[model samples]
Target chain A: MEVEETRLPGIGLRHDLVTASGRRIGVVSQSTGARHVVLYDEVDPDAAAATVELTAEEADAVAELLGAPRITERLSRLREQVSGLATEGVPILPGSPYVGATLGDTALRTRTGASVVAVLRAGEAIASPRPDFRFQAGDRLIVVGTADGVARVRDLLRSP
Target chain B: MSDAARLLVELGAVVLGLGVLGRFAGRVGLSPVPLYLLAGLAFGTGGLVPLDAPEEFIEAGADVGVVLLLLVLGLEYTAGELVTNLRRQAPVGVLDLLLNGLPGAAFALLLGWGPTAAVAMFGVTAISSSGIVSKVLTDLGRLGNRETPAVLGVLVLEDLAMAGYLPVLTALVAASGGASAAASIAVALGVLALVLVVALRHGHVLDRAIGTGSDEVLLLSVLGLALLVAGGAEAVHVSAAVGAFLLGIALSGELVERLRPLLGPLRDLFAAVFFVFAGLSIDPNDLPAVLLPALGLAAVGVLTKVATGWVAGRRAGVGPAGRLRAGAALVPRGEFSLIIAGLVGGAVVPEFGATVAAYVLVLAVFGPLAPRLADPLARRLAVRAAERTAQQRAAP
Candidate 1:
């Protein structure tokens, strides 16, 4: 039996399924699929919800269109991978020497041993900052690499 | 017209005059706040026009203005941003606070004030210019740059310290005649915590409820909340600005985003009256006696803050050029210093209060000039440093 397709509002998802004794069976998901779909079973009613599936390309496209938890999760994973190749985070202070200098000008990677991957400023997430991004007096930098590299950057920034 | 109406009209005239003078001063590249104070002086006892009202009334109004200013400042607070800044600038901010505050307290003591008074005075001066520094950095298009964050970080820490300092000072002052300082402080803190929790937990609901009403109702509610919190703080032996700032912090973000535009005109209207009242309290004849000392103190205050800021900025890993820029950017002492001085000194030594007020007025007049000076100074320093580096390379 052919089942009717229903689109969820604002979610850009259409699902086709069969209702058998209050259970959704043989569910098919369709959309510009970047979203992850979860199936839940209700014990009280003994019914199964529609199954959701998306292609990898569709997942990315959906993420771009809808900024959801899944997209954030993916970004976090990517950041973690990059950070694994670098050092830990470095603390910056006002007037300590690193406040106004940029990554390229300071030659942070070459001089310090760690590469700066992200800068968090004023509650905003700045990911993968460019070499030209200047350091502010109160910026916290996430650096990745060897432990010594991280210490080196910290020392340079803190140097009087 | 009744006395109040007549007074209001006179106040309007004074504001208009100050506005004109401020505009003229702006044309000449001077800060307008100073000019407003001067205009106020002209309308006081020593000048041609005398609007003799009690000092307390004028002070009360100015106090409201200060609270409003802090309210705006608190609106800028973001938890995540503050944490990041603290991690970066805490070490340097602490050092600067210690270095500047110690010396300032000693200076005040040497000038014959008691230990408590001296300490309070030190707090007033140790904190750098938040509004001035932020404005200058933004104007130079450096706010988005890395150095801006550190400078902002230091200011944020200073503001937080000031928050704690004001209450401590108030408690000390209140306890002077053998009152219970600890109890007073505890009550104040308790009330503050309660207010914050309520604001945070129910602010959105309150906003929605009030927002759905007419504009007048929304305005009234906003004003009512501000006044209530401010009044509550005073009732609990705390400074009103502290209450307002706390309220602001709780109601900030999305709630503030919706309420600020509605509240803007009211703040401006009250703020305008506030400055005019501040000016009217200034006696013109006293200016001659206070002018030299006030200017001297103003210079000291500005120079000390700038030097301290630059030193702190450099230690934070800001480049030499950026450090100099940050230093110059911090030169203006505006509303906050004036409010603290007024609150602490007004009741104890009116003369000292007047002196500090005069100092602030002069600084405000000089405030706008800092940005003009900072950009050129930063550029020149950058060039000089670059040339020196090039020369060293060539010689090698």
Candidate 2:
């Protein structure tokens, strides 16, 4: 009998991808971009992963399962660059210009090299802030950028 | 008609007159609180429908109003927003309090009142007029600006400070009242803690319960919760207002949004009665004796609060217009001040009570007039500052 496959949203594979003997056949990696989710999979430990891009609808369904569409998008974006970036990991405070600025201000963009993808304020997520958004005093910014870029942005924000 | 019937008739008449006067005042851009107060004055000591009640009864009613107001205030909790608001306003709040309090205390001493009386008076004057400031800021469309959150934060701190000060001052006035003071403070802190913990933990549950399709249950439960907390506070010797305020803090954000439309009108009605009763408490005969002191205090209260607000605004990087607006906003004192004064009077010497009432009456009259003064002051200050900047630029 053919085993049923399970597909996850922003991240790729739908298959249990478990072998007949219960051996794992593949790992699915999901990442997000500005407007879409990129999904690809690793078939074997020694083999290069096969990249499978999912449509926006597929990504939204997976995002709903993950309970965080914004995080899903962010993870999908990161996964596009790195095939196996963990989706469930806690995001560290980004080194971005928005570190000190209120979540609503355009100053976040000016101050940090990275665009603020979202903000976690008072236990809720605020995504894609407008130019006039005031950065609250204690808001945590989630940003998207290169590792070095994230570091630079984080440094600027972390400075008193 | 008997006294009870006459009292009801007077109250109804006052309410009707107030509704008309309030509408006129709002149309003309004045606040309704002061109008209600003035209407109280007109109907009570200053005009025809003279309903002379004992000071104790009116004061008790005012006390109840204060408690209810505080309970309503408790329903407006925004702990989630407090960090941002507090961080922005801490410096301004501290500076405003000191700047206002020091001078006020000195001024009181100059009037030859003893040190204790002077300090209590300073507390009364140091309180920035919350009603006036909020109303004018809203009217000017500046309530959502960066400066406003800070100003409001400072006001919250001031309110908390006032809560701490009230019981201590009361105890100082009557040494035997120390136990009640401790009890009140303890209850206040305990209630605050309980409300915050519960709100933080089970806020979603409460939100869902409130949202469930039972309007009567929701109203009753909310009111019942407020009263229960208030009763607990009262049992421990804390003011009902403290409990109410804590409840308001807890109910802020989603809860406030849900409950305000339902409860706001009721709050206003009680508040109106509160002010009218405040008005009714005053005796026409005593007005002459208290008039000069009241006028002096009112003038000082308005000027000092404005000056301190201006200083705080400037320090917070507010522009000249903004500074002037802040100053104007701080001009009107309200129910809180009167309530504090009554507490102080009852706790200390009864004579001081009369003095505070006269001062509050004066504030009620002039508080609404402050915003009218602000528009011209702000424009004039802006023009003057701009001219000075232009002159300096031309000099170079």
Candidate 3:
């Protein structure tokens, strides 16, 4: 996916990402520690469909899931790798290979040993998703496991 | 002790005491500014222990502190950036002045401080502490929030307003009421415009003139130029602080980045002196008389500052939570307010400084904790509001 980021002057940087299905994801990155991810209306790209704002810690968690957490945090996580514990979020969008598929069909857990701890949809939390649980667009899957295992699940859900 | 010996001992003791108090404030997660003020009061005349030193020496050091405070503030933005912010956000700035400034002026008049004190109080109340606000934003890790830009915008305008305001305040204090005051104001306007034009047009020229060859040369040249400009401005009846600020504006860009490490410590040291000096001028006994009004003024300040921040954030389309956070970040008044109070010291009622000291003490303590407190406070308030609306709708 090609992501275009534009600096908004005194404001911040706005990153516009288009998924393969043409869904637009806009993330505004503040120079400090705040990042707001907005889903744009399909027809009116300027209109905000929804916005998920995150603080530094929360954003750092998502960044770790995206495989690009801050250097310091990454180093700390590496030092703590003895526990083989990690956490990240994967946004469910249209055209994602895992969308519309049941968790059982994806074989994500079998392949990566990572488990979907929760599926958050429209502000609703669905915990410990069953194998037959269906994934829908905009559902954020909270995957937890070792770093390598989490990466595998992210690849399965996020990448086209 | 001899005058020189007394001065040396008192000055050293005050600075050291301020250092200890500052560390305590830091440990307690509060701004050390109010503590510095309190320290000043303890050593001032008619206070707990009157300093035996010649007051002129501390006053001179305080002057330098004021210059450095405004100077470093100016260095944070390029002249171009300042101009752009001024043009776009002039309305918001005007709104801030009207909403925040009016209360101070009205309160002063009501107190019978007369117009002179009202003008001084107007300035003291109007400007938010760029120093405190910036520190809070950074400490809270809120620099990236949606409402941060709006907050910065207001700060820039307030600083720019100071460029025009300080000169007027100086002229007003000097001439009191007469044609000389008008003349002084005109001269200030001329000086201000000329400084702005030179800064915007020839800032790069200055950057080259004050070459960043080595830190040593850079420090001497930058400090030398600021002092020279500030002195010249004072000679011409323009405020020295404004002169230093304009010089900082001219030296903005890569120069500021280079000078930050060199100047940061010096600015801090002198700025501390400035706060202590303001405190030193006040009599602690006077605070008892003005404490009630000062508290009321602070209440007004808290409300107005929050309102200004919220309105500015809303204009920028930030959500309610972010808006509240921005408002919280803005509540504290620090260095600039002290500088204003110091400037108007004898020109206003003798107790005016005490009022300012009391007011600042409260805000400084409140400002640091605002960001931490804002989230829960905003949430609870918002929840209660929602419940009230729901009840109202369901009743009919």
Cα RMSD (angstroms) for every candidate in the order listed? 22.3, 19.3, 13.9
Candidate 3, residue B158: lDDT: 92
The DockQ assigned to candidate 1 is 0.01
Report the alpha-carbon TM-score of model 1 versus the true structure.
Answer: 0.64
Residue B315's lDDT in candidate 1: 73
Q: Model 1: per-residue lDDT, tens digit, B289-381?
A: 766766776677767766766776677565566676566666676666666665675555455556656767777767656656765666676
Compute the lDDT for candidate 1: 0.63
lDDT of 3 by residue, B183-276 (tens): 9999988989998998899889888877757899999888888888888888777889899999888886567768887888999998888887
TM-score of each: 0.64, 0.62, 0.71
Expressed as tens digits, the lDDT of each residue in A64-124 for candidate 2 is 5655546646656775877433222123345544444554444545564566666667776
Candidate 1 C-alpha error for residue B284, in Å: 3.9
Mark the 10 consecutive residues where model 3 chain B has the least summed lDDT: B138-147
Error of 1 at A116 (Å): 34
* lDDT (tens digit, per residue) of candidate 3 on A1-160: 7877554333357777778897777777754447877776553333345777799899867765674324334434654765768777778887777778998898888899988877778865566689999989899887778889999887767676
Clashing pairs in 3: none
The docking category that best describes candidate 1 is incorrect
- CAPRI verdict on model 3? incorrect
Which parts of model 1 have CA positions greater than 4 angstroms off? A1-160, B1-5, B52-60, B139-141, B189-216, B374-377, B387-396
Fraction of true inter-chain Cα contacts (below 8 Å) kept per model? 0.00, 0.00, 0.00
Off by over 4 Å in 2: A1-160, B1-10, B39-48, B52-64, B103-119, B144-147, B167-213, B384-396
